[model samples]
Target: MRIRAATLKLGETFIGIQLAKIVESKNPKYPVGQYVTAHFGWRSHTISDGSPINGQIPALVPNFGGLPLSLALGVLGRPELVRRDRNRCWWSVGSHVGQIAKIKGCKVIGITGSDEKGRVLVEELGFDHFINYKIADVDKALTELAPEGVDCFFDN
Candidate 1:
């Protein structure tokens, strides 16, 4: 979310997180030339004192052990625990939360306004089902898809 600070006033630099390598450092925890993800958006260069920005310290990027260093920016931030049998509305978070739910083994059901987005939800993102509320009867569709009743309903 540090990318593209929407609330900035005129002439203010946007604030966001980015992948950066330490060209120089006085701190031994983060040696010179170490790769780190920092929270200073859109700047080509920056200096960090290893302080916590929004409660996150500048972490020394670990040896990936075959993983790409670019993933250090956020792939590690996903939920470590895998849950199952959950559902949500895709429009609530642009299929992001629904995808995460699917990754956790949930029987996800996404709701959108168009068939294209719905297809992406069910086909590409691996959601169990989708409802395009624009044309279909939501109540009837819900009854057909979840006859046992929906355990969760994410309305946005």
Candidate 2:
């Protein structure tokens, strides 16, 4: 559930775990400078010596071939098919999510905290439109941005 680099160990209890970069070899699947999100604990490095299940260090850093490591802690690791539902639409995590949604044939409406952020969401991030929640009415903005209803909403 937690990545080693993001974790802060307070004596015995583990606090946080961010994604960690693995020492890569010439293995075709894993390249150098690539990161791996793992449930390794609250340390800068990961050691699998004390694992109860595997009882050994992993030879490879799981299946992290072509996707971004930041997503390994989340959705890209999930095997379920992306589906459209009432809850999947509306909130925007960032331009990355918006661009991904657009690439998946879904309309993306980003709601951000600033005008500059909104501009980035639309102009740079490839969002169909952006609603600035800071300076405008949220309800009205949502109504205007997504008049056709939300198909997916990611809060990041």
Candidate 3:
């Protein structure tokens, strides 16, 4: 059995993602030189046996038609891909659509269930603003956050 070498002390885990290049491979599904994204944490290197954990293995970074790989680490990176590949069933439609909006120089405001989620949506995902629907009135919050009407609204 393979052992995961911890970067930090045992019994603690970092919840994170990485863009990894396959330097060597025996698996036909993931060839060498291909790029993959996974919740491989903060390791400099990792070994994946191509087994499913929570029904997920490493997912290939999509070919963005020559766009830089660094974009894969940002708003274009994790959300929709992981939502689909890992069977995570995340509410990704709005996030991905917001990503597109941000790319095109539009403002984005994500409405989520918790403040922590809203924080990540705004701070990490390039959203201009976010509202926690669980505690705030969405319509009122939207009015407060953006006195002018928003250009678009997305729901799933």
Candidate 4:
């Protein structure tokens, strides 16, 4: 299989996919017309019995309510699950997680590689503040931005 062929190969990484059923399934939970997300690596096809393996479980794609289902693999998935508290500070915010943290009413500070990216994080993405790691000392910037320390670090 392509998965076996790619195993232990340098520069090869597991690719995530949105699976569409081509045949009928015995499990009612995964019907023939349903779409699911699986971490079947770079292979084009895979078989699963709906049991969790390698920390990946075939899950029913969440309803995005007119938003693209692709968001399931991005913002709407693991990034939304990162813990956030309203009274605490959130740091290392990526574009998606920064929006989520802001919605949850946390003091969000984002770190990006460029000043332009930092501006996007704060001005457009609803982050409270941002630091450009390329030019600034991360430790010093973090200290100044969040003196009480970060409560959640959403490392995307």
| Tens digit of per-residue lDDT, candidate 4, span 1-156 | 455656766766455554444366888888886677776654556677888756788888766688644355543233343332221212332566668667867787876667777677777778888776667787787789888876556554
Q: 122, model 4: CA deviation in Å?
A: 1.0
Q: Candidate 2's residue-wise lDDT over 52-75, tens digit each?
A: 323333333455576534344433
Root-mean-square deviation per candidate: 9.4, 9.6, 9.9, 10.0
TM-score of predicted structure 2:
0.43
The CA lDDT at 40 in model 2 is: 57
Candidate 4 residue runs with Cα over 4 Å from true position: 1-93
All candidates' TM-scores?
0.43, 0.43, 0.42, 0.43
- Roughly what TM-score does model 3 have, to 2 decimal places? 0.42
Report model 1's TM-score to 2 decimal places.
0.43
lDDT of 1 at 101: 56
**What residue runs in model 1 are displaced by over 4 Å at the alpha carbon?**
1-6, 75-156
Better of 3 and 4 by TM-score: 4
- Clash counts for all predictions: 1, 8, 0, 0
Check candidate 3 and list the clashing pairs: none
lDDT of 3 at 25: 93
**Candidate 3: segments with Cα more than 4 A from true spot:** 1-90
Any residue pairs clashing in model 4, and if so which?
none
